[model samples]
Target: MPDRSSPETRAVLRAAVPPARRLLPVVLLGVASAGSSIALLAASAWLIARAAEQPPILYLSLGVVGVRAFALGRATFRYLERLTGHDAAFRQLASIRSGIYERMLPSAPDGLGMLRRGDLLARFTSDVDDLQFVTLRAVQPFVSAAIVLVAAVAGLAFLAPGSSLGVLACLVVGIGAAVLAERIAADRGARRLAPLRGDLQSAVVEHVTSLETLVAFDAAERSRTRIADLGERLARATRAQAASAGAAAAVMSALGGIAVLASIAGGLPQLASGRLDGPAFAVLCLVPLAIAEVAAAVPVAVAAWRTARVSAERIATAVPAEPPSGVVRPPAAAVAFPSGAGAPTLALRGVRAAWPETGTPSGPVLDGVDLDLAPGERVLLRGPSGTGKTTLAHVLVRFLDYGGSYRIDGVEAAELDPAEVRRRIGLVEQRPWLFDEDLRQNLLFARDTASDDELLAVLDRVGLGEWARERGGLYAPVGERGVLVSGGQAQRIALARAMLADFPVVVLDEPTANVDPDTAGRLLDDLLDAAGERTVLLIMHSVEVPAGVDRVVELTGRG
Candidate 1:
């Protein structure tokens, strides 16, 4: 298993599929397209000059046929190149996205907490999209251009190697311009990466997360100023990159002029010596443009490659360093546990955990913790603030990788796939995430085909039946993150979602924290009633343990 936090994780992630295999189709098509384009330009130039001389139709026939064939081939190959390139890039992007998601699974909300939501969104969305350069604007074009350039120069040598040297000289000048453009683009790339460094993105996420609070505090003006500042900075950085790209484009156009002049200068001597025919001289003058066109793409390709590298570096932080051994292999079919069935055996000893990349010197958040829950047993996990109560809850759900022996059904938890364990041991976090969807949609998210009766039953179990019924039944929209509902109502809806999953064991993390004592008691009682024979781990900060909880386990807070 590679350490995901290390630099090598990027390499490991990128090697998920064979590189050459994925790139072959796009590269082949691109090379064909570029080759055909060069041939078309030379053929058309020759055909036009021969026709102007009033040569016999048969003498011009070969050039005319060659021009037509190259034209058709160029267009056809270019269309195929785009189709192949985008298709391959999209497929690679999908796999990379899924791999990133799976790698980030164990960390969950805590891992997400390490980075701001906005920055993280940038990584998962934009940064990942930047990887399309693996084919689209980077590798395929770079390789194809090199091949086409070589072929063009080699063919020009047959007419006059002396003139070919001039074409080669022009290529050198074009390359120098591209290199200069890349240097400028590289500097701007550094500036562009700064906005995603948590400051700018953090503000965006914070203002949105606390929009209501900011409005109450009358800090909207302050936030707007900050956002404007960030926007301006980002805009300046973007313009710098665009300017660099424009410079590269200008170099391409300049290369065309330079190559054309060199062609005339180099080919005129060959024409005077009678070593090259007039029609052939026309070929020499235009052929350099083909090679120039390909070489001119170097600067943009370099910039695209750099952008992908920056994105890869940022996204590497979110990918776990130590992926489990078997994650690459498909998981075996799951063994189903009936709803409300008695729980599997749960045990832990010398358990410890810390956020992987947080660089916290205080060590593991939860240390040397020990607990055991018999089938159908209910346990309360109690601790002070920052004492790792939430960590323990996450451990129970296999959300966090821990230091010691943690097992379910007498098998080590590490031995089971984290995703598979989550299927059997459902968790309701402190702050549940509700999508902007109808009640039925949210409930059905757990079990897609769950009957309406089952959904209504779970809502009743979580004490949200009246709430659901009064609010346009199950089809009623819940607004963004359930903003339309009270804190307590949101919590209940999340609980209902879990109830619908009906795992054999459940871990409730501070589920009643936002409600009044009486409401808390009622919710707790209702949850216990709903659990019935199922094992439960109730993680709470308060000492108000409800009746019927089997036992209470306090954190020793020792490593």
Candidate 2:
């Protein structure tokens, strides 16, 4: 575990704070609201005491107006405070989430393999959301309470100095004791709750994703039991936290009563000596109750601080300060891609690379690999499992950095920007992802300006035109992860996207892996024909070579 006050954690926490301009209004409104509350209580106390003396109706009329005005101000200011405070907090949350996402991108795909999907989702969604409390529960309340407490004490001092000092002393002691008691009772539970909640969420996500496998293996009941156990632990921790907060509130209430008694005792002498009027003494005794209400925010603010600190630490841990070893980072100064005509030639000699790994390097997954493809040529790359064929594909697209010479049209690939290299070469993975959207949406992302007719033409080239029309043209849903389409149809859809992208070179890695042998042959033929004049590097394992390929290369596992 890292320190909660680490620089990374501090940076994350700082990002949660809204700018001073936006936050100033929220603080001002909070102060006005809390001040109105204290004033409301004092005015009501004075009004009642003054009425008991049978004063002129004129004096009572002013007190009546004061009471109504303070009451209305309290409610109105509170409403404005809540509105502005939440607005600023939510806007800051958007900025923080965007910053976190930007940080995650430099180490994505390969470097983030260490994080589980479910736990990562929790960090992004739940942990980031907790940061809003920095403004809502901690900073705003703490500022408002401090300002109101000082004003209340000053007003009391004007009426009865002795009672004022007593109230101030009681407030300090009561707040300190209440915060100490809450920490003692709930500190451990508060610290454990964030991680416990993440664990339970991860378990639930894993169970749901693997429900079919669990049912097939007769382990579904066991998984259910594990989820139940995690849920129970989370519930227990939540209850403990609530109990501690309750204890703190109880302490504050008792202290409020004690302050009232102390004020009354101190004010009696002044009242008897004609130093203080009856209404003044009443104000002194009763104002402590309102001040205590303001001071109650202290314990709640402390608790919010604890939770926010934990959440910030978790966010920092999830997104590392630097990209992991073997992950490629963009160069500080990169050259433009070389100008070329038609398709560009790709050549690789003595290229060695490895996937990202934590700690010490485990040597290269691909070593001493040599290959080349001329413009407008088609090549088939064959290898058994674990031979790094897919690794070679990743290297070509600049997804992973490599050691030796890989050139595009006579220029070193490393000198060019990664984004520039990707524009020239595209890859369709072994398991191509289709968005849970209609056909046009899925294809439009590759080339957003492409018309429906162009999309349909590309679909026709990939042999999905008739099949797409039968399913209601381009409006039919692909379902989540392409569940609505057969494996062969999914491959065709991916190929259609590649065509829309219009890359000079495309690498197809195991496109026929999911389809049966009968469909695989025809699918390969259709894909190759659609590729036409573009350079193609087709990666497969133990599949018959489709016709019209210009060359064949094989990778031995030794590399």
Best by lDDT: 2
| Predicted structure 2: lDDT | 0.88
Clashing pairs in 2: none
lDDT of each: 0.76, 0.88
The model with the greatest TM-score is: 2
Model 2 over residues 249-316: C-alpha lDDT tens digits?
A: 99899988988987888788889999999888888878889889889998888888778888899988
**Residue pairs whose backbone atoms clash in candidate 1:** 3-321, 4-320, 4-321
- How many clashing pairs does model 1 include? 3
lDDT of 1: 0.76
What lDDT is reached at residue 55 by model 1?
80
Per-candidate TM-score against the hidden true structure: 0.82, 0.96
